[model samples]
Target: MPRGSALSQSLIDTAHALADAARAETLAHFRNPGLDAANKAAAGFDPVTEGDRAAEAAMRAILAERRPGDGVFGEEYGITRGSSGLTWVLDPIDGTRGFLSGTPTWGVLIAACEGTRPVYGIIDQPFIGERFEGGLGVARYRGPQGEAPLRSRQGVALKDAILFSTFPEIGTAQEAARFREVSARARLTRFGMDCYAYGLLALGHVDLVIEAGLQRYDIAGPIAVIEAAGGIVTDWQGGPADEGGRILAAGSPELHAEALALLSGTAAEGAA
Candidate 1:
């Protein structure tokens, strides 16, 4: 089936419910004095906590009951191939660094993909009671203030745009140099927001997010939300971000185009 064809309101509802259940498991470990974290990667800092495993396990159990035929690909536990073409991409705790340090910026990311294309995504920050959902021709935000439609800010210039990256040290030397080229031209640049920055972009608070060294689970949910909110998400070379590496998101197409030029090094520094 094509993207969005297999998706229904029922599936979306189930996605939200999965996030809710995962949130409970994650919260149980969040900030717990006894919570233990270990580095999963040998070279880089890839922290995995008991919370991450427990939360993903919780969601997988729910999926086994709720969507038995659907596949599951998760950050913590890896893939469970299913007969159904639709697959759930999950990151139980997107910002484990923030979660470990007691910051609420970390969120539960859930996305449903038809084959390889994502059709539905939800960024659930349970601690803050905020949920940003997109796909199915509508994007919405829910929080203490209540639910409202989401639309990205339009016609923002690159020089006046707000840029975010999970870290300045992402990717190789060449890639980092390319990122700095764009960051130098932006009006303001902030780092360490992780997936939260993408949610903010969908809400029109942040303008551009450039990051590298990401997995599919990291970008899937954010891409759905940003695109549904009238934004653009693509790789550094202007391609789909489905496989997740060196992704850039802009609140508007114009901003994206301008940034893409710099990221590709096709434009001179400070080019208007």
Candidate 2:
């Protein structure tokens, strides 16, 4: 349907319910998170924990019972067969390292992409007690029953900006150098943040999110929420969202292009 006017209300409700359940499960583990992280899939990569596995499993089960025809692509568990028209992308824990580091940037992430294009998105930070969702030209945030409109900060300069970046895990040396060079000139830099920083930006807390290396799961949910809040979400070269090489999220389009001009120069040098 590509997020038409006549979308499924049932699907939206299912997304909310799934997000709520994920929040509950993730919150329980957030308080008493025990470390049993194993490298199951990749070398030096932490596999799914009891919390992640349980949460994803629960979501999978619920979806199976309700929308049994929708396919799923989860970071922890991998792909499933169902909706070719609708795909559910899940990152059981977006910032597991942050989750383990006693930082609050860790959270649960999910998005319903209507055929590789995100139509509905949800970012649930259970520990901090915030939930952000965007779809169908409607983007807003909520804590409980009260929903409020979210607006991005306007008239912000790059040198006077706050950047939320996590480059150490995903970037190569060249990419890291470029990230550092650009971030060093920013007003302040916060690192190792995943979707949480984007959520904050959507809520008008931060200014920019610069990502050089990412998969579809990393910025999938944020793209919709941040844009819904009247911000810019794009690749490093300032293109579409899902192409996935580098990403720059900014509060305004002007700042986005400025920062992108600087970062893209770096990317060009690296290519040279």
Candidate 3:
């Protein structure tokens, strides 16, 4: 719905509540020596820790009490259909692997999505005590340095851009080759920041983040936050990215276009 509306405000409030609940639950198991994960993937090591489940359950409990009519699509619990025409997309810990490794980059991602589009979102890092919220006329960061408005960097050329991806060997072989093509021209390319990378992008500390083989919950919160901070987020084909798949987020439209062209293998000669 529209920003500042009663429903909008309520949704924003509920998102924060969810984040708060997740922070408490996730931190309880964050660095515990007994922390163990179950392989969720059939072929590979897709781990899910106790912290992930506990956090999602806590968030779901709050939603059941506050926004009972809203649907939920969570990484741990799957989907819970509701009648409110909205869905709470939750990834209790966006980087379970890193969380298992005791890195502070793991985060709780919560987005109040209307249909497939996120209307408000929060990326909360419990260990760092940092929260980045966007959408619904709110784009700000709260961290040790204090609160600040979030504005993505503008006018950075492709060659000067700082690029980030969660994994160096992104997606399939074709996708990895495409990613390398863009990385070759960027000023710097780093990996494995997870959702924290998106937070940095919205804060204007980073310029671009590209990833593939993502689910809706993986990118929904980041999409709302980054776009609210004057950034552009789309698929490699330049389509709406909230549905996931391949995502390309850049601090500015010009930079996004350059990166998109390269990712799609459509840039003209010398465009990079």
Candidate 4:
């Protein structure tokens, strides 16, 4: 918005609009047996339902109408021809497996990026009527209870913290092995959370969020929201987690490094 004015409220509006559109379109497919789920990547592989495709298409359409020049790269649909610096990364449905199973853990993820770096993000859980959005300076939470500022939990060590993730099913072979090492080092691990799992981690209910086989859209929204909420997020290799590799986010820098070392097999029992 306004060419790089990330803090400007106008920028926030676009993010919110896209979030609203994607969330509505995604929920429209819930509980509808008639909806089609097709293999989008490899054969018998990652599924893409009408929900995902329509949600992304809806977001793209809104961008076309409101921010005519902004580029959009989505999970279901490919990139649309538009601007580069002003971009929107979207995961129309994060927990598609859960969605297909009639679970409500799925949600719509969106983030605004400038020059390949995120400036703002919004994760909308339409079924639960909740939204996590923020960027420039700070982040805020709005839900059925109304709006409030959110902060990460303070000063927790790995042994005392709770960890959340997608588990081995969502990871590649190499990533899965690395994840086992990390799990052994964590206090505890829980499975079957998509993007919502990361939101819970950022909100301080959980301490660490480690996910693998994630696409750009999968991590972009969570990265912006969590970082804005004062948590640290990065790739598994201890580098920037801009959809570069896998993702690991922790409540603090200490935990972030410790988790990275555990996954990397270089740590000596929380030595990081």
Each candidate structure's TM-score, on Cα atoms with residue i matched to residue i, is: 0.96, 0.89, 0.97, 0.91
Model 4 per-residue lDDT tens digits across residues 47-103? 779888888888888888878887888887778757536878888998888777778
Q: Between prediction 1 and prediction 4, which has the larger lDDT?
A: 1
Q: What does candidate 3's lDDT look like per residue over 1-272, in tens digits?
A: 44567877788888988998999999999899999999999998999998999999999999999989989999999999999888999999999999999999989999988899988889999999999999989999999999999999999999999999999989999999999999999999999999999999999999999999999989999999998999989999999998899999999999999899889888745565
Mind giving the per-residue lDDT tens digits that candidate 2 earns over 117-229? 77777888887778888766667788755778878788889899898887554377766776776787789988777788888888888898888767787777888778888
The most accurate candidate by TM-score is 3
Arranged by TM-score with the best first, the candidates are: 3, 1, 4, 2
* Local distance difference test values of all predictions, in order: 0.91, 0.78, 0.93, 0.79
Mark the regions of model 3 whose C-alpha exceeds 4 Å error after superposition: 1-4, 268-272
Q: State candidate 3's TM-score.
A: 0.97
Residue 82, candidate 1: alpha-carbon lDDT: 93
- Give the candidate number with the greatest lDDT: 3
Pick out the ten consecutive residues of candidate 3 with the lowest summed lDDT. Answer: 1-10
| Model 2 whole-model lDDT (C-alpha atoms) | 0.78
Q: How close is candidate 4 to the true structure, as a TM-score?
A: 0.91
